[model samples]
Target: MSREESAAQARLREAAAARIRAARPELADAYDLASAEGLLAVRARIAEDTAAPEHLAAVVIGRFDLASWARATCEFALGLDPEQAAAWRRSFTRTVFLAGNPDNLRERFSFAHFADDGSAAWTDPGPAADSAGLRRLLKLFDGPRPLPVRADTVVEIPPRAGRRPDRPPVHRELHIAASGCRVSDALVHLNHLLAEAVLDGLIRPGDTLTIRHAPRLTGLTDRFAALRVDTDPTLPGRLRAAAGLTEEALLVPHHRP
Candidate 1:
């Protein structure tokens, strides 16, 4: 790119970064905002729409860039007391998982959660075979009233046998304990985990992912909802098929200063 073109790109990135910082002040120190290439990629993703900075920040956070997420979380935590840091971490983690691409989520399932009223306003997916399975899995949390309790979901991805013989399997767990949270939120969190696992190259074709969700309730038996998903090679292909992109495209090579 020419100097003038580069300068203009830099200016655009700076404006976007400033807007993001203004909206999400806690993410002001996020390394992604400081990255020229990262900002360029974010810009390219939303090139068609004149989205607000809050929406832009949501895109960045929902990108599931592990390195950037970890760095921002650590840096922000360093400035807070232990208790506050822990609380912030929980909130940040939930935001990262819940802020995923809504289009992708809608393609698979129909879901909605109203935070103000803690009321469920969602319909199950169509009567397809896969949708039937999903409906059955979600039945564990079915109740007349919203449960005011916490639920922990554990996702276990076994390491690819031949590719990474020495690398260990990835095991991740997340908790949905916030006030006014609902089962739909947990489903979104799970969907983000599956997408992130594929993007991170932690999950491979033919691998079976074991997922379990245990709700904490008093005076109730500790019953956990368990399910396994067998991933095919086309799973990754389907995810990347969006926007006619074969793989994640970057405007430029990303590197930290």
Candidate 2:
């Protein structure tokens, strides 16, 4: 990458780091996850799962409604094939929708998954791994024959205010695009972990759980050096445009709903 390109990339990482630190301080401290790396990892993981004919499920719960967050997610889902836009819809949930209650302001999108048991689990709001989650959980199995269920039903996974994350569940990293744009690090890992839990049936529908996305950086060379600070020396926006990242939704917003 050119010096200008490198500088722009650094700026993009800075913006991603800052956003993650400010928004997800807990994960920021633990995982040190960054944006670009996280998004790419998730895209790769989802693509792998979707390519499989078997059903796989996962949940992405965060401070939703931010156009940036939505845009980034939409871009990732559509990353594999633009014309195959419907592929994500079919692989995960069939709809691109949001769910929440007035009491709780969280936007969540869930994909599909199967449990170790014979049951299946989807997204629902009730208790932490409540019957709703369990009901779907039970559906994963084939008493006689297994069938995929893509219900149009909408349910809310009740709010659980205090929760924590299990550290180092799996390896995760961030990869900066040739362009400067970045996503969230912990967020991407969290998505993968969610998939595992869903597959394991540890998280049933209607069951609420806690997740964290700590901001961090990895794979920097021992001789790595900081970028020169001249004329701001960073242009994440321009780089994002250069990279296809410009087409994504507004990720993190200034205010909360």
Candidate 3:
């Protein structure tokens, strides 16, 4: 990429990182969990369950809103007064439309995977997402499903507050894009490590980052991402150590529309 293009890219990622850095406490907790032992256990379990990084990434970051909302409504059904239900309905509508798996439609799309190379693997949220979000929620409103008769089931549906991630899970894309060699492996490996850090909680989503992989004199390197992470030339080992990374993998950054 040209110097101008690179600079613009850097700015975009910076904005994302800034948002992540400035996140509220409740939302930050989820990002902070990236490095916790429990999250590590979750990652380990996920790795054991799948051989593909794509599968691992999916489990790490898939946004499961439909099911969560349903459970929440059921638990608070009796408490859902007319106004509360309307509010929830509006919230639920926006959610299901943007994030739910609506079986009612002949064709449905999802952004469950994070796109590393900028290839849009699914239908991302757009300008009309809110109106459509509500419509989609209404379709799935088949009254209430059969809840098991039980005493006081607990429900916790924390509203996803603060700045939401603009894209869905693209962890695999980032990993593959960053797994490169010494010629310019710095950015690639660092980003790959960052993805794990995100899953592990070392790096929060929306935190601006940059890569320092030196471009070849002959041409630009194959390192591209939706948001380029700024890196410190002195602290490569720090990132590696934090993410428990030992090897370097590489790929060219190519965003397919």
**Candidate of highest lDDT:** 1
TM-score of each: 0.25, 0.21, 0.21
TM-score (C-alpha) between model 2 and the true structure: 0.21
Clashing pairs in 1: none
Please, what are the lDDT tens digits per residue for candidate 2 over residues 26-111?
A: 44544434445663444355467534443222333332322223223322332223323222223432221222221222223242
Off by over 4 Å in 3: 1-109, 113-118, 122-191, 215-257
Candidate 1 segments exceeding 4 Å error:
1-166, 202-257
Q: Count the backbone clashes (under 3 Å) in each candidate.
A: 0, 34, 29
Ranking by TM-score: 1, 3, 2
Candidate lDDT scores, in order, read 0.31, 0.29, 0.29
Decoy 1 TM-score against native: 0.25
Question: Which candidate, 1 or 2, would have the higher TM-score against the true structure?
Answer: 1
Cα error, residue 135 of model 2, in Å, equals: 16
lDDT of 1 at 74: 23
lDDT by residue (53-147, candidate 3, tens digit) is: 22111111123222233222222232223443333322211122122333322244343332232221222222343235444443332212322
Candidate 1 to native Cα RMSD, angstroms: 21.0
